[model samples]
Target: MPPVPTDATTSTLANSPAASLATSQGSRLAQRLQDLGPLLGLILLCIAGWVLNPDFATAANVLNVLTRTAFIGIIAVGMTFVIIAGGIDLSVGSMAALIAGAMILLMNAIGTAIESAYLVVTLGIVFALLLGALFGLAHGLLITKGRIEPFIVTLGTLGIFRAYLTYFANGGAITLDNAVSDVYSPVYYGSLLGLPIPIWVFLLTALIGGLVLNRTRYGRYVQAIGSNEQVARYAAVEVDRIKMLTYVVLGICVGIATVLYVPRLGSASPTTGLLWELEAIASVIVGGTALKGGEGRISGTVIGAILLSVISNILNLTSIISVYLNAAVQGIVIIIVAFLQRSRR
Candidate 1:
């Protein structure tokens, strides 16, 4: 090459690193934007709803739509932790139904449909939580000590819990009769400064969940275990304890949600909480949390819940088709979300 002019060579040398740095920074920013696809999808869906139907964008409609998602969102929070820790919990849905049914029956036994019942409701909550913890314990022990797959263990509990709830209902609906109704109605329907009670419940869950997952040593152990159990064990982590603690935490979330959910529908049926575990998983995946573990995105999961509710809300508000097709729409959205996740990975 011919010798360059002094000023030309100086300018070239000064610009080269600047150009390379800009390219590197641009790539990083692009990756961040790409990682935000789910959030973008949620916003796009909301905007689409707004464009298609005026009412879908209203405050009343948004609040009404979101309150119902609180239950699933709460459960999904736990599912986020479980899946990130490299485990799964299928019995959450059935457990919700079972716990809700059991709680109603407990109140009913304490008094029929027409007596004062504060103590009963209090005890009912305590009992339901205990039952949830027990179920979690059973699942954790079986998987950790018995060496069975998490899938099979939770699946077995899923059927068992569903059957137990069905049997408790005796093939009929279990309603919160008048007496209990007065006592428990506010649990779900009550508002705090113009917001639904469950919304606050979910916010608290997110706050606590975030703290536990980010600030604690257990959180690091969990990520390590999920990323590689063998390596975690070799590093002297208490793999079993962390895993069991995670399941117990999941059970606690389910119990808390049940306490809120029962008063909303005011009854329990076999179909209560049907397919909710799938929804929870979908929300977790949509949040960009890794299914295989070692990574987590609680914020993404919350957004995922909002996105799903927004989709169904639009479908309902616009009266797009037969009510039966609602599942079809949700199913399709879930598949799309899943494919997006896999492709990103």
Candidate 2:
């Protein structure tokens, strides 16, 4: 047996180092493709849709899908902060729903019931931002001072906000009254210079986020903290403040998303923004932002959210059976994208 083993070992002398390297190089190429699986999947899907529908590539269709994506895209931008900080915010969907609901409620309660649609909606938007910030503040304090895990804290708030919204509408839809509806329609429907208002908002938000995350010292600290909070603190970083700021940023994003959201439906339901957190997370991960934190991809996240919206819009426009099944398809896409993202590392 030992003699036979010696011959087997001697076989290495028969192999060329060049061939061995070629094999290793082949393996690495395969790994790279695996890493790029999600991006490839997206490209493939786009090609397939283009082939399937002549209208799929039209400016109208593209614009429509992009407009819808802005809501989640904006929220995901804020989510980038929380995730990059090595925390999660499950309450985002509930938070958006709550804000949308409260905004509509406040518009109704506004003094003298202002007839100007934009003014009422403007008031709602401001109110939503402030309220969402309050919620974020609460979340930040609980997580920082109480020393609780962010997942647990956000999960608790997730349930609380969802339940409150349910209680808000008495388990039904909350339609904007006709008077308010007339005033609110233009906020979502109206456009500036032929572009949808939401589109402009998303572009601006992305630009601002890009500047903050990629061009500032605070961004460096965020990545450092996410990479290793212990090391960050030891380096004299303001860990608590950074963490709190992330939450607030996320809250403000949710508020912005809510402003666009309510005008679309002009009402609030417990279902408003349902599962949006999942979309936000998917957008961040798919966009190339790290799940465990440390790095972020703002542009990638923006495109990711658009891809999601496109998938949904195409499904709705096509002759797909059982509209309810659309969600299952979305879940599948998300799982596939997430799997690809994780596999890359």
TM-score of candidate 1 relative to the true fold: 0.87
**Per-residue alpha-carbon lDDT of candidate 1 for residues 277-333, written as tens digits (9 for 90 to 100):** 988988988878878886666778888888888888888777767898998988887
Compose the digit string of candidate 2's lDDT tens values, residues 1-345. Answer: 122222122223223232233245556676455446567667766776787686888888887887889889999999998898788898899999988888877887772467686677678789999988888888888888888999999999999988888897899977676777777777788899988999999999988987787666676667667767776787777999989888988999999988888889888998888899998998888877778886666777887787788777767667655787888987787777766655334
Q: Pairing residues by index, what is the TM-score of model 2?
A: 0.84
User: Which regions of candidate 1 deviate over 4 angstroms?
Assistant: 1-31, 112-116, 320-325, 338-344
| Residue 121's lDDT in candidate 2 | 69
* After superposition, candidate 2 runs with Cα above 4 Å error: 1-40, 111-118, 319-332, 335-345
Candidate 1: minimum summed lDDT over ten consecutive residues — where? 10-19
The positional error of residue 86 in candidate 2, measured at the CA in angstroms, is 0.4
- How well does model 2 score by local distance difference test? 0.79
Top of the candidates by TM-score: 1
